[model samples]
Target: MSVEIVTARWIVTGAQDETTPVIHDDAALASRDGIVLAVGPAAEIKAAYPEATVTDYPHHLIMPGLVNSHHHIGLTPLQLGAPDYALELWFAARLSMRKLDPYLDTLYSAFEMISSGITTVQHIQGWATGDLDEVLGAARGVLGAYEAVGMRASYCYAVREQNRFVYEADEDFCARLPAEAGRVMAAHLARQKMSFADFMTLYDELKAGNRNPRARIQLAPANLHWMTDDGLLAIKEKSDAEGVPMHMHLLETAYQKEYARRRTGTTAVKHLEKLGLLGPQLTLGHGVWMTEEDIEICAGTGTCICHNCSSNFRLRSGVLPLMELQRRGMVVGMGIDEAGINDDRDMLQEMRMALTVHRGPGMDHSAVPTPTQVLRMASEHGALTTAFGAEIGRLDPGRRFDAVVLDYSSATWPYQDPDIAPLDALIHRAKTKDVHAVLVDGEVIYRDGQFTRINRESILAQIAEALAKPRDTSEQETHWLRAQVFGEVERFYDGYVPADTPRIPFQQGSSRV
Candidate 1:
């Protein structure tokens, strides 16, 4: 077999625990046929395989390409004229956002990811309002972008059998409106209506027709309130039938916590546990408002959590008990939900946020997240949540050779202290601009500010051209209807979280200073 040697100043063979060893001092990784074969000192690797071709990054540090474990939408809601409101209120505001071409939209986010050391994304595709065939075509477009770009994607069509707009049933919420508005809202909901069976069909067709070697079909429950128990059961059946994993969004806000207590008279985790849904096969996304009991249940079931740190902050969703989850031996991954704090999908920035956000307001150092823990979240733990499984997260033998090289000059050239561990320095200082090259399957897909397969400029220009056009009739209609319903949606939630409900994350929904 043909062999390749990738050399760098340092090579961190992705961490799994606080004490996982890291390679240093001119380390090199050798691979054959896209699978890692060996990693060692540069000279030893080269001498052992003198005939192998070398791709050396003398000024860089190499590590596993990160996984963006939870994501949705290419365009940010802020860019679509929606303000950052609470999670529930943000739903109505999102209706005013403009529709986008699925192919170009997917490419936009894919570019952002590959350029910033992220090679895999859990793209939970949803919010389609059309016939089955039309939505299927959009799903194809999303997959097509990832395949063309050579980025690994664990894709799922989010299943929402109810509660498309609010926590209440779609019919119930629409029926409560004034007559004229009610008619309009019902018609709007009609276009999005699809049976649980139809969603399964969508999954079957997508899985059968998928041509992306770097992509796999998965399932998502959308959210606890969005799916009926029957709908969730159907998803479980489909998952078991297909042998695929499920990523679900649950307990993202204090309001959602209240909604769950109202529906099942128990915490969301206990309800799911009773339904036999919690397991290693499932990942809970957001999970910001999970209680200590919920965390314990997840730990017991070996269920995974994808913590969207920035989303929780931006939407005023309460923070998940991350410190507690770690202590419970739970597997947690980091995600850039919607967008990062600076309004982009940068996993490096995401890692920093996850590292620092959970540090309590005290002088204690033992419980705070270590650099090793954050790296695990972005790499190995993130892989657990995706269909890729143990295939592509680490730079280890028997795994695919996917890695990113970052120029160490930016973070360490100016006389930084030597005693700090390699990961600690990287976690605190690295930025997107420091990413020098990204390799997937031992093939360099990105290097020196350019993608190997896709043209960033051309794709972006096409997107700009599309959005520049004046609003179409359908688009204009959606904006108008959203304006009329915005106030009603706000009123519907007035005193929604009863005074008796226990608030673990925040005592109140939101209050201005």
Candidate 2:
């Protein structure tokens, strides 16, 4: 709209290093038409923007809005009836999840996401079984929900050329199964049948029709095991030609590491490097299994990473080398993945998880995570991974006016040391309930536990009613089929990794002497 001033007790500049960070106490920022105009002391900002409408919070901390850089589905797998399994088997187990309308499902998570101070997301959608048009419609449903909710999103329908289930090719894997089970499994995969040409075409079509100014489109190569050599090359060529970034899932699990070794005769990151696909325009979703050298390659090429901490733990995937990745100068971002530790999209918790999980049993403060580093991952670095680039990350002149106001008094509650570091307190003590308001593009979309653009209660009520029905016959049959074939998928990985193994992630040499 017009010039507006948002003042708070403290302002987190979203800029910091190991021990030093710039937090403005008794500060404010001025914005106009969705762009930040200036930021300085509260009195100076008020005087500078005299005619601007003022929204002042005397007991809140204003910080840049968070970015969930590697999100997938709207509803988490747990909510959709899938139990926690390792990353590989979890894919097969997810086949039985009852289908919900994509629009409502997206809104279900958007509510949680926004309430948790997430204003932007990197939504990498995939695994829809349908024709091109049908799949495009599903993409529309998801993008529409974000638009309706006023959440900025970088949307991509991940391009998966092969290995939809196990590490083997779909056809070859199904061919070895029992005749009856093979047929059912083949039939299940047949629904998702799409050609490589269709993947490129789908990206072009979506890009042309995307009407949301706040939203951007990108190409995702899905995962290393999922893409064939030619398909990976094609995706890289397209990304280079079109100047689009690619958010890919690679080396997420130990099984995936083994799969890469088999397929590429090297590590997954090395495989991408060989293919000439590692660069600034690519953001790897979960580099959990990436070796020390893999981290070096990524850092060398300016490759970004989205650390899905909760997802890795939830799926029993190995922990990411967050400390090493950050130390080697990689632009690592934070993501909740399917859900956070508490099974929701709270970024504060995700940041906390990142902060605490990386602390080794050592007294070296330099090796441990700093509050500013984690905050950067959740805000600035996370935004960098998405198509949003430098447009929506920081709270400063020239950046988009997207930020969260946290009730400092409520967050610190009955007692907090006045001399305590502001960033430390914000990261360690803040909760989703402490979010007083969220602004996107200079507009207050959510404030005082209410969404300004949409009705949260109505959406939640609708979702509850919509999912109240019992499973239909088709859903029941899918569940039975998954049960029948679960053992088959498990058997494929029986000896995937030997009883004795070495060279695990974040470590350089053999595990044993």
Instruction: Supply candidate 1's per-residue lDDT for 9.
Output: 87
Q: Estimate each model's TM-score.
A: 0.97, 0.97
- Look at candidate 1 and tell me the lDDT of residue 206: 94
Compared with the true structure, what per-residue lDDT tens digits does model 1 show for residues 167-196? 898888988788877888888888988877
List residue ranges in candidate 2 displaced over 4 A.
504-513
CA lDDT, every model vs. true structure: 0.87, 0.87
Model 1 segments beyond 4 Å from truth? Answer: 19-21, 504-513
Model 1 earns a TM-score of 0.97
User: Quick one: RMSD of model 2?
Assistant: 2.0
- Looking at model 2, report the run of 10 residues with the lowest lDDT sum: 503-512
Q: Write the per-residue lDDT of candidate 2 for residues 1-513, one digit (tens) a residue.
A: 679988888888777675666789899899888999988899999898789999889988888999999888877888888889987788779878988888888888898999989999999898787899999999999999999999999999988877787888889988877888788888888888799999888999999999999889999999887888889999999999988899998888888888887777889899899999999899999888888788889999999999999998999997887888878888988889898899889888999999998887667888888988888898889999988899988997999999999998998888899898866897899998899999889778899889988898898888788778888876787887788778888999999976676854453323356
Report lDDT (Cα) of residue 391, candidate 2.
93
